[model samples]
Target: MPRPVRRFHPLLFVSACAVVLAACASERTLTPEQYEQRLPALEARAEANPSNAAALRDLGEAYAQTGAYRQAENVLQRAEAAAPDDPKTLYYLGVSKEGLEQPDAALTVFARYRDLPPRSRFQQLMAGRHGWLLRALLRDELAALVAAEDSLTAEGVTEAIAVFPLTYQGQDSLYRPLGRGLSEMLTVDLASVEGLRVVERLRLQTLLDELALTQNAAFDAETVPRLGRLLRSGRVVGGVLDVQNEQLRTDVALWDWPSEPLPGLSSRQAGLAELFALEKEIVFDLLVQLGIELAPAEREALARVPTRDLQAFLAYSRGLLEEDAGRFVEAAAFYSQAVRLDPGFAEAAQKNQEAQAMAEVAGGVDMALAAPRRSARPPGGTSLVHNRLTLLNQNLGAHVVPGDEAREPTADVPLDPLGAEPIPDPPPPPAGGN
Candidate 1:
């Protein structure tokens, strides 16, 4: 019998395991009652194996499901220490933080979630969560800053610049959207300059809208200083765009806001087709006027254009307008058009994802509910082969099969996977594809 021992078939083993898992996943469902039933067993496993991250994560999630956030937080912290960079653990930890009303801590956790390379739908959901939380925090901070506008000084925000939407002085409504598009381009380019901190376009717009400064009046040189003071910006950039006969003329001014000094103004003219080149010239000129010396890499980055296709830029600009107005659905549509027109426009692609995710978040899609849970490996002392089989079998909803010790499956699996809720179809592309 020893001489006739047969060879182990690796491929057959893999195929058999795959078939079993496929068959079992079809039967797994963790209803509320099942999760409740598994709580005691999950607790026992964690208690017996204090250092097992998997066991702790399962117990913490079960506790979170039962609304015991404090206990969940305690175990999740242990799980995070044991399994650093585990998205599942970090996400559940963030939920516990939110339930504990720790917005700052939750933001930090979600920021880590956001920085992780985009790999799954759960990561995408975290990106949206991070953005939504940031905006909410910014709004609260802005209210306090505005109330103390008089106390703001040049002591801080010295290197900050705020770019407002360019004033449009043209009869052709078709080109009006460029006001926002040009301002956004300037903001992005100027941010490349070292030693300068550009206020985000969205944040600047939010503040302007909050102060009612955007309602009836255009942002002129006189208004720049006032806005800079309110925004705690040391420098403010505002400009006018005059277009006639397919020719473009730009008048840009930089106000040294805190000191109430005379602003430096510059003008440039170019054919509409040469908009990108003209914008580069304006950015360089502003840098020179501000006494900023650009490093070679910074100069190179500034020279890079976002898009060569005018139509794509137009679509992207329209998306910005829609997004700023809280019309995320329309914004997503326009952004999608931009991507379709110019597939290489990275900014457009990122904005499109953000718009879609934001739309989902706004529609009351709970992040915790949307993310699927994975089974964790059991604690030490078991054979590696048996441990893996146990975890895989539990994940696939299989019953314990002739195992060393009888154990129940972790009840963390989502009953309905995120795939059940597809990102809503972007509304049909604009009529005539424009």
Candidate 2:
């Protein structure tokens, strides 16, 4: 047995591994303009090495980016044949399918991309991009559905609605949870705004549960109308999900509950984080459609609350939110706390000052009368003049005769003795001589 043993060629094994890796790592980096300029070079490369899958894939991507879908398909198909199981070739083919508006076919390619090893940097990038595109497409479909719903004026219109995962082959359950989480987060964020209403997933799930409905189950159009009426929501959001290049892509859509013919909004994208962000944006637009007013305070709160190191700012936002909610006392407390945390936090300091002033004014008649009215009048208008005089008399009487109250002194709080002298009138306007 020892004498019959054979030796393997190390160099040959290394070469084979390198070729496989190259095929697996195949990606095109040419920008649209660069791709256009290098088309001739790519063509020459392909002509010189007809079996070079990488070159063919790159050329196909270049063609797809330039709107040459048919040519891209042809080139990508050849690449696929050349490297039957190569993820890179599969991804390029998917891109070509997308360019051709064949999303179903493209999804299959993206699915294969998702199954690649996570350590591949090329796969990572493609996965993220593919997920993003898929989510965007789903969002577009949703928007069309919403639009269809808006187009309907009838009191009773029915439509069927189903949402499911769209992964390559049958890997459906893997990314579905992310899709559901994203939908719920979006609904919650949007619903938190005043004058906006979003249908929460729990309610939807409950309804489905009551009916023993699964994602594959189809409800009648008339049933949708009834569901819409019960939910008090005219639109429904749904989507498909897939994995590409070890990344997840989701396509979400908003559609009319009973008339799902048109989409209200649709978007496809890669990565759960990006999909969540897009969902926020879509919800924001929906709020706008529902006539929700995002106040300046709300906007500022949102901008500041998400920052980890901005504790003072977060406290300030809490204060403002409380104030807007008519919890002035709580607002003052928050603002004061904020100022204590960061003495130089000017906005918080100012808010604290205003809240204190307001509190004093609310409790004391003198403070209430002393505070300036917010109006478009000149600084020392009639009311201000009267108030100033009243304050002067009260102070003077307090000093001269305790407990002897007097009407506020008119327009003349005594100035500092060294203050500039008042300028004399110009001879009484020259006695109106003009």
Top candidate on lDDT is 1
Candidate 1 residue lDDT tens string, 1-434: 11111222335444545654464355333444555667777776777678978777777777776667899899999998998766656666777787788878977887886565453444544665667767767777787878887787656556588988988888877667788999999999888776789999988888876677762253564666656766667777887887888688988888776666755557889888788889899899889978988888878988999897776777788779878877654465556666766778888877866765554344221334323322212233322223333443343221212221112122233211311211121233334432
Clashes of 1: 0
Candidate 2 lDDT: 0.46
Cα RMSD for candidates in order:
18.8, 34.1
Residue-level lDDT tens digits of model 2 in 19-114: 533532442233457557767666666666668776676677567656677898899899878876554456556666766778767666766655
TM-score of 1: 0.70
- Badly placed stretches (over 4 Å) of model 1 are 1-50, 153-157, 215-218, 260-265, 294-298, 326-329, 362-434
Clashing pairs in 1: none
Model 2 off-target regions past 4 Å?
Answer: 1-31, 147-434
| Top-TM-score structure, candidate number | 1
